[model samples]
Target: MWQKVIIPFSVSFILIGCSEPEPLVEPSTVYQCAALTLTATVTDTGLDIQLPDQSYALVETISASGARYRDDDFAIEFWSKGNEATLIINGEPFPLCIEEGTLPTSFSARGNEPFWLASLTGQTLTMREPGSEQELTVEAPRLVEDEPIMTWSIAAEDGLNLMILDQYCQDSMSGQSYPYTAYLGREGEKEAGCAGDPRQLLEGVTWQLAQTASEQAPTIQFIPESNVAGFAGCNRYRGTYQLTGEGLQFNPLAATKMLCDETAMAVEDEWFRQLTEVQSFRLDAAGELDLVLADGNVIQLQRKN
Candidate 1:
């Protein structure tokens, strides 16, 4: 009887609840407005901005048209419509902020004096001049080392040949920098121009050590097809690289057998070690390439102009 009465006693219970996690923010967008470049990262409720001089965080605000963001102090404001944006600093508007477009993966070149354009897509190579355009099916370009410069030679039908140098060039009129200097040869005539694969920032441009101090700083140049060649203080090295979703990785590097003093060899050894340990790479606002290592150290490099 006592057991039956105790069984009628009240019981207590506890309840738990859970909420969904917020989604991650999308990748940042780079915008080139006139002479200024800006990188904007959209957050859950606001924007993280990176200017050449400084960085700013702004909250979303009401706008008549397009999206607008402003800081609490009203020191900076960003207004965007489609791919265009206007940046306001201290109430002074900087308009015409056009978004930077990605360049095509196909190789392209252009010259100004005589107005010529050439492009290689797949097996077809197209050449265009003032009033003439020609397309020819050609084989892939062959690498030819011309001493200090690396050149890619393309042989086409009808005795047409095109040579592209892995060197930096600037347009005479527009003053735009190109990764490669190109020469188009047909019959006995040749035309010189600037060529590039604009999508590849590390390609063609020579990069020199920016942070480390040395009389002969280490240098690197990324070639097409995942090949990389560099001067590592004492000897020249060549290796392959892979660009994955996570980061950049280099295969086992091979260097020329050249002996030098202890100082140079030491520098070379350190550089090779760093290159092997690189986990990722990024370009800073100042257009310097930063190679992040697994040990949380950074190897900075600048474009050799």
Candidate 2:
């Protein structure tokens, strides 16, 4: 009898020892599908973030854990969980809009005294100091706010964060204040100053296909301003282009109606698809131009000038 009782007790203790405890982390949330692009803007008195589908203005809320951008008088926090993100300003909360789009990699703005210059590549943010070659390269900015003036916060190597400010302006006629959007890093907002127009460097030169989805030696010519014409394998095509941020949006292309060999037509189809899908571009160290698409496809072209 004692043997049976001790055996049962030993089995129970063994089972209990083998059991595991529950995790201490909070349950993960499933967020609704939305865009990932975040556009930050500072208005006269508050902040406005343009999301993929809608816009959210800043409002009051309790504090939450996330990235923080702080100044002497104000603070902004950015929280990202799963597929969603929120912006908090001075204890206030606001929904952050996100979209599936490419962010601008480089931009420059000119204003009084300190010139506003910024470039984002991958996870890095580089801010060029005004009138000097010196620059502050840090992690991507986490918070952007307009307390009547525009401010940006980036995490630095040191404990202190780097802050960028854009002075506010009041319309004399209406008296409504607004941040200098032209001088700040506004999403989808493109001006002439940033990393000099990539087209300006590509213009006046013939580009021969170096690498593409189709193995065809197509050629292209980019006229100054908004005109671009190219030959895809056997067909000559023309289209207008609009540059926004670091991406190029192409108008409906006009191509000559002609019959070609099967290989050439296949190549042409691939070329047209590549052109339409192009969203951003970069000039590699080899001096080759790589036009990137939303799906991460790349059309590589080499200068034949």
Find the candidate with the highest lDDT and give its number. Answer: 1
Q: Candidate 1 regions off by >4 Å?
A: 1-102, 105-199
Against the true structure, candidate 2 reaches a TM-score of 0.38
Query: lDDT at 108 for candidate 2?
Result: 37
- Candidate 2: tens digits of C-alpha lDDT, residues 91-126: 744323232221123333333333445554444555
Off by over 4 Å in 2: 1-195, 212-216
Q: Write the per-residue lDDT of candidate 1 for residues 1-305, one digit (tens) a residue.
A: 45544456787877778789887767899976533568999988699889766799999999999999999998999998866687888865553465555222257888777888888886688989899999988877777775688777887887888788866665666544565788888779887887864324565357888855446889988765677888999899998988653567789999999988888888889999999898777666686777889897989998765
Q: What are the lDDT figures for the candidates, one per model?
A: 0.76, 0.52
Worst 10 residues of 1 by lDDT: 96-105
Clashing pairs in 1: none
